[model samples]
Target chain A: MKTVKAFAPATVANVSCGFDILGFAIEGMGDIVQLNEKESPGLEVSSISGDDGKLPLDAAKNTCAVAIQAMVEDLGINPGISIQLEKGLPLGSGMGSSAASAVAALIAANEFLSSPYEKKDLLPFAIAAEKIACGAGHADNVAPSLLGGFVLIRDYHPLDVIKLNVPQDLYCTLLHPHFELKTADSRSVLREAIPLKHATIQSGNVAGLIAGLYEEDYELISRSLRDVIAEPYRAVLIPGFYEVREAVKGAGALGMGISGSGPTLFCLSKGKEKAIQIAKAAEEVYQSIGLGVDVYFSAINTDGGYVLTE
Target chain B: MKTVKAFAPATVANVSCGFDILGFAIEGMGDIVQLNEKESPGLEVSSISGDDGKLPLDAAKNTCAVAIQAMVEDLGINPGISIQLEKGLPLGSGMGSSAASAVAALIAANEFLSSPYEKKDLLPFAIAAEKIACGAGHADNVAPSLLGGFVLIRDYHPLDVIKLNVPQDLYCTLLHPHFELKTADSRSVLREAIPLKHATIQSGNVAGLIAGLYEEDYELISRSLRDVIAEPYRAVLIPGFYEVREAVKGAGALGMGISGSGPTLFCLSKGKEKAIQIAKAAEEVYQSIGLGVDVYFSAINTDGGYVLTE
Candidate 1:
């Protein structure tokens, strides 16, 4: 029998200007999944911890089990794996919690099988899990959690994903308030159509952001980190969103935006000291509103998921 | 009196994925404007060539004269400049004819003042001329024509133009059918609003194209050079548009799109040989329809507008 423990970093999707196509992995926070081989030819959920009984116990509904099942079918191997998910990220807080779990479980299962699949090959499994959790199989979150650094989903029909260059000095500060905003609820607020003028401006910003990342131009990044499409509608869902953003930016953040959907916000800064300052500024905003928040600050995770123990 | 002859290369705006923000300069054809410093204090349009006498003769109405007037005011000097306009590019042919004239005149005027304004500073003068020519002060064409290479107009309110790195081996093929399409007419066909899904896809492609240019990955560039915003509505304005695009792509062009608005199409290829092949393929499509076209092939113009003689 073989057992392995794996960890995958959480991801921040959209990154402001890149609505549904861009994301990046961050360190210091993630979900951990442990897998053990069994003689039975079926996947099972052995145990779940840290979720306060909020997650489903049924293997068919759990993100980790669903992802492992897909991986099993892709490998053409009998399912004899049991998954144990440890929830480190707050569920449904726009921190890519489900994606982290799926990635961690897939990495653990691959490790049990002598690592037959490369990291990129595990994307389909993570996407499957995403569909089960969020009802949409967007790769912006999963791709970064798998490949690390900034990942751009160029197209979805054939699943074209590219890993982008990450500036070494760039750091991320994530502020997760203790609240839940369902992905579907947040998405429902967006308009089905947008003005052509806004679309053009959004595209310009997206292009500028990509160019900024490659050139390491922080000023350009700051200018481009604006979400004209979704922020206007979704910002109301998060409490004190504008105040928090203004505070973080005033503390010298490059830019701040709602991560994924709502309740959680991410700020990008130049270095650790700036990231710490931004986190403090954001924390004060939530504190004044009588809401508790959890903060994570770290450099970009260059390695997405890794085996912790075997 | 200081007399100067200046040449500014034509430009291709939008560049498929970049709707209103991306453009690049091309070689082999341009407008050459000769500026003669007059002893008398006043700007005058001495003579215009190759324009079929269609352009305005009044110094206030001509694109060249309008640009030079702006330059004269910016230099805080009395207007003692007389301009001779040479129209190498077709008028209203979607080949940046008006922008080239404005850029050439500005360069000539700058040379007459011992080049007080750098190339980037001349963008405002060119934009002013564009407003008179097309009723919009867009810098997509003028920025590239002034600075050369690929230029991204990130913002317009306070005009932020960034010059991106051009792949050394990249070549452009410009096919101009002997017809005219007004920029305003082409723009009128586009809807005021677009589906959100299409906008997201368009932004993704824009980001991918910028990343591809920096990475020098031809395959990525090919995959990303798609225009979902304007091409669908405006393609009907160009006869045999689909056939020409198909033939050019089949001839191993990275991609093809309407140059600025309509009537002129640009194809990007890896090398000169491939560009020539793409040009031949595009020509055959027009020949089948009994239409004649002028083809221009050259590497991207690294030097946008320059002083030939002073």
Candidate 2:
């Protein structure tokens, strides 16, 4: 194959109850990357768009380039490639922007090289790229963005992941309040230690959330959608978070919480109508606080990342 | 009905990864309670057996009596009842002895009153009784003992529970080391706070364990069966625990850990044959330490508590 173009969906991690373990891909919001073969013996970022000139042009420093470099090294095939990055998602909006870019580039590169790796096999490279972008190797965001549906990171050391079931009727509503909250800053607000009591309750909720997904019990999911670990600490960073949460709850959202690390708040609902209603309610809260919000309604993306053309 | 008898099986709480949230019922060990109607309107403990006089006979102090009393109050039926307690499980062996007794009494009382409550509706009464026995109203032990199979206590305040699936081929081997570790003392050894790093890993494992049960993935279950919260602190209380764990692991056991709170160590295996082998191996470790041990082999009990006769 001379060239490959791919789109990778945005993902919401933490999922309220499952901090650093659970996440799901969403449709409609994502990043696109294109890889073209070059006669020169080096990879290059030929052009970039839609990132407001914020992302680095240096290939080594870019997430997409970093992921592609790892893939090239692992495959032991140094194919010269020129890349184009089209950023469809906002940076630091907690919608996994860097992950989408990294996953898209790795997938595109894998396709251009005649597919030496499986979809899941590219996870390590994507995670490595994520570390370069965010200074941590968390799979919660990248796994779902790469593998789609709902992904649970069972263990990090051995890179264990399980694809969990998402109810067909479930829909997601995300409101990105036109602002940025760096992943590092959001993480810094959290406590290094937590009470054993809170830890136990959080653990119970994680188990409950998984059970709820398996059983397809919406009520169980709603009841278990609570973050005893991070939400309490990070809530201060997101403006009007509590007001938006209450508004979405009143509009019949199954659950509502920070989407990834914040600036974006997400609500899960049983149907598209309720999801849209939740988004509207949340948008009103953001507007009341004089914050411009971009709202998106989507269903769970079953396909994590895919090539536009083979 | 003039007389009613019931048996509630022993339970293994914590389940290695789910401290204070997950538990499963085990066959072959439990407590049996008999409820006999009296002409007068009062509750009383008529007799006791199999406990060697270590249990309290006072209705308010005894687990069985306390459970029956709560059931009576909840049902608003003041019928006189005399109870006979038959304790088949050892006390403070981490086999959920008090939970079995409490569940048995509530089930017996419910049966004597002609099934005034559904099987799960009696959970609160049993948990209330557990509070009297263990100084806290935790349902991990009681839920599995009462509802059968595996149960996850999702929330404690409103008492939410989700019954999880267990693979049919899975078997359990339990070794009671002829020693007592009081629940209070077992709890005291734990720190009031835990590092966030450990807590996050523990949470991931809880989600992994639940996913393992749902997918019927034995390897996932084994890999996820780690207790970062409780086992490390409580391992010292159980004599020869480390040696027996190694022994069981060498005998093809998937994973091994404290059953509930020390003295009793349990191993999980894929079949009854392996379970028995693991038990024998664990027994040798105890014997080498000059300690007597009683071993039991069981599958996950599907029936938590059952009436002797319908």
Candidate 3:
């Protein structure tokens, strides 16, 4: 194939109780990448849009280029490729911007090379790219972006990934404030150690959330949506976090928590109507505080990253 | 309704990955309690056996009597009932002896009163009794014993319990070394604080195990059966734990870990034959070290507590 284009959905990581282990892909917001064949025998970032000149243009520093580079090395193929990145999502908004770009590039490169790898096989490349953005190779965002739906990273060493069931009626509402919380800065606020009591409760909530998803128990999910480790430490960094959470809860949200590393807060609801109401309520909290917020409503994306044409 | 008898199965709490939250019921070992009505209008431990005169006879001090007393107070039905306890499981064997006794008495008393409560409704009484045995009111042991099969105690306060799925072919092998590790002492060895990295991994394993159970994915369950918080500190208390674990793993057991705060070690395998092999392997490890061990092989107990008719 001379060229391939792919789109990867945005992902919500942590999922309240699961911290670094769980996440889910969402529709309506994502990134797209196009790869065109070239004779130079290496990848290059030829063009980019939607990022407002914030993202790096150099191939080695860009998330999409890094993932494509990793994929090329792994496959032992040095075919030249020119890339174009469409950044539809905001950076550092906690909506997994880097992960979407990385995943989309990997999928596009795989398609252009005649599909040599499975979707899951591309996880390491995406995670490696994510590590360049953040210090750790966490799969919470990349796994869901690559595999679709709800995904759990069971272990980091062996890179074990499990796809969890998502309730059909579940909807996600994200409110991204016009601000940024760099992944590194967001991570710096967390404590290196935690009390055993808090750890046990967090573990229980993780188990409960997984159980709730499998059983489609909305109340259980709501009750289990607590983050003792990260949320308490990072909530102060986000504007109107507590008020937005309270407003979403009052609007019939099943649960609400900071979406990736923050500057964006997400709420889960049982239906689109409730999700819309939650979005409105959350927007009002930000508006009253004299801050601009972008609201998006979407369901769990069953498909992660895919080639637009073969 | 003059006389009622019931049996509560032994439980393996913590279940490696889910310390303080997960547990499962086992067959072949349990405690039996018989309750008979009297005219005194209060509860009493009229008789006891199999404990070698170690347990307290006072209703307030005895685990069985404490649970019965709580149930009586909650129901507001004060009737003189004498309990005859049959302690089939050894105390401090890490097989949930106290939990079994408490659950058995609660079931017998409930049955004698014409079944005033469901099995799950009696959880608090059993947990309260457990607190008297150990300093904490943890339901890991009690929930599985009362509700049957695998149970996850999502939260202790406002007590939320979720019954998890058990694979049909799964078998358990338990080896009780003739040594005691008091629950208080076993728990005392754990560090009050844990590194955040370890806590994150533990949370991941708990989520993975739950997903494994839901999908009946034995490998996932085995892969996720790791205890980074408790077992590392408590392993030294159990004699030959390391050797036994290695032997069980060599014998093709799916996973093995300390059962509760244990001198008892439990192994999971896919069939009775493999469970038997694992038990034999574990027995050799103990026997070679000149220590006697009591081994039991059983599947997950589907019936938690049951009444006996006379």
Candidate 4:
């Protein structure tokens, strides 16, 4: 087999209205994983650029390593492997940075050894790795990063992950502030349960969001892309949250919300120009709070993860 | 303006898994409303057919009358209106018979005055008229029957409604048994609250349903369509429910669930062949139970409400 590599983009786990179930991919905020077969019986991983600290050399403790090991167990293939991860997406920022690394590593590893397993087949292993990090397996991030576009994880007798087609001219403007809200931390802060009214409103928004994506009506899409269940509770943790959302709204953005948990605030705009405008306006709000911010202008990633180059 | 008439299809409120929020239109199951300028400030309603003695001909009590009344109140227009309604859909059969009349009347009245209000502007009155019948201001049926296609009604604020494009081969087989499940009665039977785990599963299916619509994968669509929230509680009212669903599934139906409330069972199939197979199989079940059956072999309705032979 020829040498192989792959890239899975970082995904915003909850696109406002869809909490724990809905997610979309951002183009540039991603990690690239490269894999090669060797004459050994185990796995190895190394962190390249984009990550601040050295990734664990041991394959068992790291997210990427755990995912690969789980896949090996599933396929019962004892092929020796080595992987290099180009971690571009930020970690611990609700934007599913850990999931990107884990998914990319697994996709690369499985593909390099010949895809003996389907994408959905590998969800449990990937989710298990996520559980180790976030204390639970929420497929909101992993599914999108692994499969691409907007993914729906239907947890049932047999779990199903489905992807939605995003319309054209829709762009995501992402702003990560100088803070990190770990998934575990965010999950802990939330109430164990919520009011019935909140659930009803949230469910209504979920229906509307799915419909908006199908219809591609920007105005309605914006209006429907609301997170009444989680955002109101989670937003309180993010500084300058309302101002940033207001700025994005005033800049002609369709919608704005905290990406995943918090610290990173993102908005959807009509085009690149509007995305940039929204980003600039959002940055000013972030700066007002004396915080450092990183901005990304991206579109809905239709193609999520695959062998980009070999 | 030339004399004009409009027909809107009766929709299925609570499209199986999506109760009180999601709905879709059936092409031939609705009421036709016609309005023309008359000399006096009079609004007359004449029910032509298919009421089963359930319709009120009174201008104040008729569904069409109530909708037109609300429209006139809001518009403050004195265009003397002559309204004619031909109710094609069965009354109080889980199908949104009342909403069809409501939306159709409002649309005819709007067009009578040469489009006094835009379609988006007509939602409030549509819901209000629907309220006159069901004693609730819900848009699950009105939005789709008025607009068309799969719809999500997220928020009345700024009115977030999105129309999703259903797949080309998305065939639906509906089985209507001779029974009545009033919206109020079915709603009353449901628990005011639901189990959290059960809610999570349903949310996953909703996510999967939306994702399945986008990706155009029948397998994913079917898998993502499990209903854990309401179907279990509501499916009891329909006789031969389990047998119909099983027979339909045995006939290679992709997804199956209750159409609206009771008696009518709808299943999504891969194509016309499977739809026919499921329909035939389902009809046999209903016949064996000695019940009246009306079956529709249709697609996801794209054109909701429009003028009929104006």
List clash counts for every candidate, in order.
0, 1, 0, 2
Q: Write the per-residue lDDT of candidate 2 for residues B1-310, one digit (tens) a residue.
A: 4999999999998889888888999997899999988889978998889888988989889988888888888777788999999999988888999999999999888878878889999999999998999888889899999998889998977889889989998899989988878888888999999999899899988898898889899898899899998999899888888888899999999899888876788888998999989988988888899999999999999889999885
lDDT tens digits by residue: candidate 1, A40-159: 898999999989999998999999999999988887878688889999988898989999999999999888888899889999999999999989998888999888999999998899
Worst 10-residue stretch by lDDT in candidate 3 chain B?
B301-310
What stretches of model 3 exceed 4 Å from their correct place?
none
Q: Which stretch of 10 consecutive residues in model 3 chain A shows the poorest summed lDDT?
A: A130-139
Worst 10 residues of 1 chain A by lDDT: A301-310
After superposition of all CA atoms, the RMSD between model 1 and the true structure is: 1.1
- How do all the candidates rank in terms of DockQ, highest first? 3, 1, 2, 4
Per-candidate DockQ vs. reference: 0.92, 0.91, 0.93, 0.39
lDDT of 4 by residue, B1-310 (tens): 3456888886766665565567777766678887766677878764457776768888877878888888888877666777777787887777777888888888777777778788867888888887788787788888999998877666666556666657788887888888777666667667666654555566666666766776677887787666766678777877888988889999988878876665577788887899899999988988988987888877778878886663
Across A20-103, the per-residue lDDT of candidate 3 in tens digits comes to: 889999996899999999988998999999999989989889999999999989988788999999999988889998999999
Alpha-carbon shift of residue B132 in model 3 (angstroms): 1.5
TM-score for candidate 3: 0.98
Q: What is the DockQ of candidate 4?
A: 0.39
**Residue B13 local lDDT, model 3:** 94
Predict model 4's lDDT versus the native.
0.77
